[model samples]
Target: MGFHTFDVDRADALEDPGRYRFCSREELVAALDIGDGAVVADIGSGTGFYTNEIAPFAGRVYAVDVQSEMHELHRKKGAPENVEFVAAEASAMPFDDDELDVAFSTMTYHEFASDASLEELARVVQPGGRVVTLDWSANGTGDDGPPVDERFALADCVDAFESAGFRTVDATGRKETFVHTARR
Candidate 1:
């Protein structure tokens, strides 16, 4: 199992521009390498912040969140035309086998990182499809995000993806965050 769910009441913080300090749109899009008409999913896509940044680059972008309230907030914030909101858990998405060309998650990975979730991602993303994950690192100082005890290191992400049949393309551990790119 993963960590606890983010309290929906504090969802506003998810949209702050200062959040770019951890993960910027340019780096995220570059990490995705999304092509025209490619199918993508944003796992734990809280209020469609990063989802909006990615929608323009892909054919279909699934704004996936387990909480219905999160989806509602994204709708209120004006989700893009091609963006479809899916109220589902990261370990149990509704997409078909090998349906997604790419998938990504921001700081919310700690709440959904699990063996089952990684297996689910392997099942949904096509072979060679990229999965980019950026989240709070276990090695970080307890400055921002959840407590350091709840986060995962870049190596932890590499192990999880590898166990689920993904090839680790890159793994970087920053001061307060970690980014792991894997290919299914």
Candidate 2:
């Protein structure tokens, strides 16, 4: 299904505030180890949460989402000079191969329509570029989070990335969060 039906305005309404508090933009960015002059892409960057934080550290950031309303919200929020909003599907990013130094998606991989999204992510990053993912931990218990089946387990995510030609570098579970860092 296309992402046009996604309600950008009500996106956060689907989330549990208390559970997401630990996955705050500040904490996620710090964990990324983002370097100066890095080029990054925040796929499924709803509302520019992670995009806004990483923009300052990176030379350029591509905030990509399929929904126009989502991109509209990101634009209205006024991203930094280094950030550019793009309307594109997660499985078909409009970026050249080896163009980005880092690619990140927060609470988004599970929402991807299929495995194509993982292929697209691996295609865009340089051979040594890193891919970082933070999503709901599958153990559940988060404050009123999405149904258990809708969430992607950390192991499944890692396997998908590895199958897409990414090498798993780290995997950790903290609080209600699952973080994975990999290299393409």
Candidate 3:
């Protein structure tokens, strides 16, 4: 993560259901288009909130986060049986090349939106695998999420993914959030 990471002290905010106002579990699942036996990873998973939402639909779900405290919080929250904890950064994960069927992030795209990180995603996800990202948009009013100055616009995300060798499937820049789905 390049910008300020989520503070572990305010982790309770991550668990609040109201946080779903900007991005919901349903929208994320739809964007992912998970297969019956898909192996997926939830990058920057804070407390297995969205990770738990996707685990029942996927064969395996890796909860990947750079902070051990976040994983610990997830552990305390009791994740699903199929959820695996991965304490690693987005740009440098432990997974083998072309191993993942899909990878996604919720409100975390801005933190790891560098060339190295997007390229790492392109490297890990197999061909035809999808990469879904939902985050605070630069187009949004500075009311609910991070400042617009730190967020990325829809075109920025599309360019980054395309540059990293993924093909855009769909993209929507909404009021406060932007969702993008791309295929490797």
C-alpha TM-scores of all predictions = 0.98, 0.87, 0.97
List lDDT for all candidates, in order.
0.93, 0.77, 0.91
- Which candidate tops TM-score? 1
lDDT of 2 by residue, 1-184 (tens): 2133346668665343554465776777766667789899987888886688788888999988877788777777678999888888888988998898998878776667357888888888989888888876777675644556667678887888898999999988765668899998
Residues 1-184 of candidate 1 have per-residue lDDT tens digits of 2657889999999899999999889999999999889999999999999999999999999999999999999999998899999999888999999999999999989999998899999999999999999999999997999999898888888998999999999899899999999999
Lowest-scoring 10 consecutive residues by lDDT in candidate 2? 1-10
User: On residues 1-184, what C-alpha lDDT tens digit does candidate 3 reach at each position?
Assistant: 3456888998988899997887888888888999998999999999988999999999999999989999999999999999999998898999999989999999998887899899899999999999999999999997987888989999999999999999999999899999999999
Point out the higher-scoring one by TM-score: 2 or 3.
Answer: 3
Query: Residue 66 of model 3: what lDDT?
Result: 89
Candidate that scores best on lDDT: 1
Could you tell me how far off, in angstroms, the CA of residue 132 lies in candidate 3 after the best superposition?
A: 0.3
Model 1 ranges with Cα > 4 A deviation? none
User: If both were scored by lDDT, which would come out higher, candidate 1 or candidate 2?
Assistant: 1
Clashes of each: 0, 0, 0
